[model samples]
Each structure stands twice: as structure tokens, then as C-alpha cells.
Target: MPATRRSSLAIAAALLAVAANTAPALAASAPAVPNAPMIPSGSAPHLVGPHGEILHSSSSNWSGYATTGAKFTSVSASWVQPTATCDGNDSYSSFWVGLDGDGSDSVEQTGTEVDCSEGSPLYSSWYEMYPAYPVNFNDAVRPGDHFTASVTAGDGGSFTLKLSDTTQGWSHTVKKTLSNAALASAEIIAEAPSDASGPLPLTNFGTVDFTGAKVNDKPLGSFNPDNITMATNGSTLATTSPITDSKDFSVSWKRSS
Candidate 1:
């Protein structure tokens, strides 16, 4: 059928408008915005491998020792929760000891969180099994408190997470159960937790010394673990402070972002 002159003119005009607006519409939607930091949540970060396995990247927000390929039944570490400066907005970080979640789907973990909420430094303790939300404990953790935390895996997906403040002679423990956990890697770490937007900025915890790090019945040195330094965009975010013995180590905060 032959098109009418008026109908042909309308179609041409519509096509021209569409082409003129396409690039502008795309440009409006494609710019990336900076993400603000928030409190920690959910599973830790990893880059998915081609084979569907999790792999570590230098840019990750974790600095610590991870033992891979070994089934970890238990992991533990001790550190003095450092007093953090809350000069910057939305600054946060966590010091923890955990099994799994370094490269797999599940984490049985517990530790202390140092976060700046509205310019005030806040301290607390919490535990989480991945795929489920984390829970904060009622126990008070002050700056410079000596903390010892441990996580142990048990039969039928049961697990135990314990946190002790040896400086204050206070301790809290919880037992919970999870399903289909991989039990892949064990870690003792200082982490900038993930938020709805991705990795949150680590708080200025100054220097955190980790002592008595152990997995199963062996010290961290016995496993030939990876000493991780968290970085991003060619800048260092955190670093392993030092160790007189592998059983004891530290992570020093470099920059918040």
C-alpha cells in the first residue's frame, strides 16, 4: 500500500526526534555518583571467578590472614579495640575473627564495631551468619578495651560466636545454626563492611594490635597465611601494623576511603 503524504511526514518527524533525544537520555542516566559510607552489613566482599569460586583482590576492604582450601572448624583472635576519631562523616570499621565468607557464601563471625554516628564515636559488639542480618549485642565496649573473639563450627550447621573483654572482665557468647555453609576459609581481619551501596569507608581506628590469632589448634604463622593490605585506586586504605610473633599482628588505618 502506498503511504499518505501526511502520514509519511509524521513518521519522519518522529524518527528524527527519537534520534536527537537518544544520546541525551542515555547521558542523563549513565553518570556514576559517589557512594557515602554506612554501617557494616551482610557478607564480605570478593570478586567472583570464572569458575564461580571467590577470589581475593588487593583492593578489598579487608586486611588480615586467610587460610584457604582447609576446613576451618574454629578461628579466634584478640585485639584492643582502638578509640576511633570521628572527624569524618559516615566513617566505620570492624575488627573480627571468623570462618568462611572470605571466599564463600557463609560467615560465622563476631567482633567489635567502631563507627562514627553523627560525628560521635560509637562502640559495640555484634555477630552474623551471612544471608541473614547481623545483630548487635547489649554489652558495652569502650575504647582501649581488650577484646578476644572466637567462632567455632559444629555439627548440623550449628555454630558458636564468643566475644570477651578481658580488660573489663566481661564476655558474651551466642550459639546459632546455618545451612549449607562452605567452611572454606578462616580469617582474622580488620574490615570496612559492605552496605547497600558497596564497601563502606573504614574508620580511623588509629592502630589495632591483634594478638593470639589461631585457627583450629595452630597459630597464624603455622598456616602460611596471606598478609593482606587493603587498598583502592592505587592508594593504601589500611596496612598490617607489625608482629613480634605471628600469633600477634596489627592493622593500621591509613585513609578512610
Candidate 2:
């Protein structure tokens, strides 16, 4: 998982959990899957311009805006669920808002996912307190659903992760604890989700538009965020747009890699 440094114990536990159940509680909906891990493939190297402007950065699995250099307490964003165009290949993507994944080990995050399996598309939602496995919500998720999500850090290693699909009339709230969380950065991202092996191919999720992006109750751009482009082996997989109104932006899928 990209910023989630899972321990051997966590991996073993996740595998056991999956082995214990051949099927999820509901057959018609997505199972309580845990494979979407944010494992950082590589450090995002920051590029600064001559005038000291934050130019851009690149990651293997992440594309969006991440702000560091401050102790961030909260991050929030809203986006319409993107429709995934599936082929025969298995691919995965997620849209989310999170904290502590830029330079730190843990990520407290929640959002939605679109995955391709056997030429079909699966839409679901989930949250992860990294190092631990992600827990998928059973709520029905469809393309074009309006979603809002946030991660807020409280005192004493406590945190709240919330995701709401207004288009579907449902919401999920999770409270977790990460005693060593860095609170180092906040981000709104579109990601190519990963598993134990490494990053999976990105789904063709056309474009996801993010709005009302905020960190610590202020516009995200106020902190000078890094615009991340997702690439691997010099091949672009996704690209993030420049932030406008200090709050809105979009991420477009480029290739499956």
C-alpha cells in the first residue's frame, strides 16, 4: 500500500480474514475486500521553479495535491464518482482525501474505489488506518454518485474518517487511533491502488473533478501544495490539473500502467 507500511502481522491477519470467508455478507454487492493498500512506490521528488514556486512532482500510484511543512489536523474534498471504463484487464483506482501519507508512514483516509474484474466494473467505498487493513463499506456505490470525505485528527492519537455519498443517501464514519501518526501532510488524491505485490494497473476513470478542497479549514492552495503526476518507469498513468479558486481541481487517467 503507497503510504501504508503494513507489517507482517497485518498482512497475515488480512490473509486470514479473507481465507475465513469465501464470500462477503451480501452476494449482490461488493465484498468486504481489503486489497486496496496505499503503498508508496517511491518518494515524490519535489521540483521547485526559479522563483521558488512549487512546480510539480511524480509518484507511481498517486496524483493530486499534497501539502507538507505543517501539522495538519483536517482535510476534506468532494467529487462525483467517476465511471470506470473496463476492458479485460484487472485494474483499480480510488479517489480520496487523507493525511500523513506524503512524508510519513501512516495514512488516515477514506473514499471510494472503482475496480475492473473479468471485464466488469465494481464500485465500492472504504477507509483505512494504515498498517492495518482497509475496511470496505457495504453501501451500494454507483458511477456519478456525489461523494464528500474528510479526515480529522483529534487529541491523543484519535482520528475520525468520514465519507458520504449524497447521491446514494448514505454515509460512513469511522473512528481510529494511530499513536505515532505524524500529522505531517494533507492531500486530495486520485490513486492507482496497490496490494502486497505492488501497484496494480490504473482503471480508465476518465476524469475525476474535485471541489471544496481544504486543509485545516483553509483553501488547500494556501499551503502551497505539490501537484503530483502519477507515472511509473517514465510512463504517465494519470495527471492532476492546476488548482483553481484555491480549492478545485481534476485528475485525468492517462494509461493503465
Candidate 3:
């Protein structure tokens, strides 16, 4: 606290002229920005302007008239609308939700039970109607029949489903359906369904909603539905149940010309 020395020589000459103009602008911009594409300074690609308003990347942290990232803490539009486009409309983007997607055009399920033992049944069932148009896990669903399927039961039963399985010639998704309208000729006269025979072909797997029913595929001492009814037609698929009072209940098929 002696003499002032003229305010510390004018703040040391303004800190040496701001360190000589920041070291020559960082040595002439580090060799013209070598290895560029480094937009990572907290990842930047921000576009959410306003006049019409549009900027969205929310994990959820939006608040008030100025915000960014992790979330802006909490505040929003009551009268600040601007989803972007005073007049440049044309945005097409959204992708995910497609594992045989569920746009449902023909995926039926039904029931109207009264099983006196298996003869008072009226039912319907069809799976994979529209959402199954994405085949080719190995291509081969395009045989002489073009992937067929069928199941009609209850007094005039019907069952047909020939996807070229001279014994696994290549086709599977009946991985099991139906439960047993005699299980389609006892697994199509038993065997060569392309080799691994016996258990699969249990086309009559009735586990949809009647509570229980499983035949030749025998999940364990089968048949248990007081009643059921179902339907489908992207070509053909039906089911009617009665279980056993003798009004005739059991159908099957495989046709899709």
C-alpha cells in the first residue's frame, strides 16, 4: 500500500495485448483444421428456430423461451407454437415397430363355446394375415402353392396347409396352429414332413382363449374348451368348436393358389 505506480502500469499493458491476439489465432487454426468432422463439443446439430417454431431432440427438459440439452428444467408452450414451417411442409420420417408389424388387416380371433365333450363347438382363428409379408429368412415360401393355409371346423370340418414339407422342404409357422380336428390326417399321414416328424404338425393348438385345448401335440392330456368361434379371410381360415356332444367339430386345410 505504498505508491500506486500509475495503476499497476495500466494493468500490465492490458495483459500483453490479450496474449498477442490469442497465440496467432491458435497457430493459424491448427493446420487448417486437420482431421475435421469433430462436431463433438457436446454434440452439435441444433435446429429449432422460431417464427413458426421447430426444434426437437427431447429426452425431456424443455422449459421457457430459451433452453438446451439434458433438458431445460421445465417450461413450455401455452401460446408459442412453431413446429417449423411457415410454408415449407414436407417431412417424412419415422422408423421402428416392424417385427411383422401390426397394421392389422386380417389377423382374426374368435370364440362362442359350449363343449359338451367336443361336439357343441363353433370357433374361428387366423394368425399372421397382413403383417407377415416379410418372408425370406432363406427364401422359399414361393413354391408351387404360394404359401397356403386353412382350418375349418364344426360339422363339415376342413383342414389344409401345404407349404412344401415333403418333410421340411422349407416352410414353417404352422409351427403349430389348430389343436386337432384329427390334426390334419394325423400330421399328414405321419412323417417325411421333411424328416423330423412325430410332434410338430399339431395344427390344432387351441390355446387362444377357451382356456385350454391341445391334441396330438399333447402338451399334456388335451381338450378343455367349454366353447369357441373364430374367423379370417385373406383367402381362407376358419374355426368352429363344440368339443364333444356330437354335432361334429373339427376342420383342416392348406390352400392359397
Candidate 4:
């Protein structure tokens, strides 16, 4: 895969500029998904293996998984949305479960975002089929709400993404088709999305815990595992929160870059 365009630092920045023009503004009271691509952007540095599999990432993000040799047909995780600190900057971050795009052209992902704009925080749910942009659902999400997200590959290049807010008793599911999917990696991540300027400043959301993580029906630890932290400009941006078992772990917000 040779660190395809999606993971390239230069290309990610270029795409951000193009996509930013179409990105939507934060909605008031109701969460809306911005038109951000789910690929790695320049602001967050990520390491890739010889074949292009993601090894680790730094800065406003963390990716947790074991390299399953791309055979993963599905991935899932559950987390509680963290309260985010808004400092009047247009900062953003997301917690998602995805397959591919770490080392492949396609990523099928679903998650929730906590974003700060104009001194306030916006909460929303979304699903993305990458290369394409993310689509926001109208589901109401609040800090501390329990959410579960998953994506499964179907026959003939089809995928089904599902999101559930157990705390709020709301759920949404969608099925879509995407050709050229590499299916080369699966990840559970907390990320900073990109905008015209760059990766939008990361929101100062506290620790986000992801539990019941599984790939191909196997627990996260069964594959090997990479614990990631985000760092920028020689400063730590995020750290892996403590976990009692492989099935669950956390990514804590350090300081925004």
C-alpha cells in the first residue's frame, strides 16, 4: 500500500484545504457532522509499517488495535462521551471505530464528536465512508452518554454502519456500498478532524474510555496491540489511560497543540 494518499502528511493537508470549503458549521443544540474526510491529516503525526499499516499516531489522537493482517470484516467499541472544554476556538475531536484508512484507501467508521466553536461545545453522531465525507445523524448526544458504534463489511463491497446511544435510548443504522475498499486494518481511535487551516485544534475533552472492543469477533488483545499517544511540537497531547484488561482502554486528553 506504500502509505497511500490518505495517510500521507502532504496529501492530507491538501485535502483538508479542499474539503474545508464544504465543511458545515456547527449546528446549535443539534449535532451535525462536518464534511471532514476521515483520513490522517497533517496536524497529527502517524507511523506506518512497510506495507502501510498504521503502527502508531501522535497528537490529538490515539489508535488501538492489533494488526490482524487485514482480514477483519468488522470492528466495534463502546464509550461514554466525555465532557469537553471549549475555549472559544473552533476545535474538534472524535471517538470512532473504523476499518481500513490506516493503511488502505477506504475507511468505514462511525462515532461521536465533541467540538468547540465560539466558546461552546457541540455534540453529534456521525458515520463516514472515507474518501467521501462524513454524514451527521440527528441523534442527540450529551456528555457522559453511553454510545456503541460498529461497522461490518457485507458482500459485494457493501457495508453496514450502526450507532447506538444506550444512555439516551437512540440508535441509527445505515447500509452503503463502497468499492475499492482495502480492508487492510481496523482501529478504535480518538481523533482530531481536519479543516481548511489544518487539523482543527483538538478539543480539550477529558479521557474517553472504549470498552467491549472486538475485531473479527476476537477481543482487542487477541491480535497483538498497539497503544498510541498523540504528541505535537515535542509536547505530549494525549496519553493512553489505564485499563484493567485488553477489552477496554482509554485515551486521555492532555493539552491541545
Q: How large an RMSD does model 3 have?
A: 33.3
Model 3, CA-based lDDT: 0.18
Candidate 3 residue runs with Cα over 4 Å from true position: 1-164, 167-223, 231-239, 244-257
User: What's the candidate order when arranged by decreasing lDDT?
Assistant: 2, 4, 1, 3
TM-score of 3: 0.17
lDDT of 1 by residue, 175-241 (tens): 9998788888888888876544456677899989889999996887677665667876667788875
Which candidate gets the maximum TM-score versus the true structure? 2
Measured on C-alpha atoms, candidate 1 has an lDDT of 0.68
What digit string (tens of lDDT, one per residue) describes model 2 on residues 236-257? Answer: 8999998999999999999998
Give me the displacement of residue 129 in model 4, in angstroms.
0.4
For each candidate, C-alpha RMSD in Å?
A: 16.2, 4.4, 33.3, 6.5
Name the better of 2 and 4 by lDDT. 2
TM-score for each model: 0.76, 0.85, 0.17, 0.79
| 10 residues in a row with least lDDT, candidate 4 | 1-10
lDDT of each: 0.68, 0.79, 0.18, 0.69
Backbone clash total for model 1 is 0
How displaced is residue 8 in candidate 2, in Å? 16
How many angstroms is residue 23 displaced in model 2 relative to the true structure, after the best TM-score fit? 14
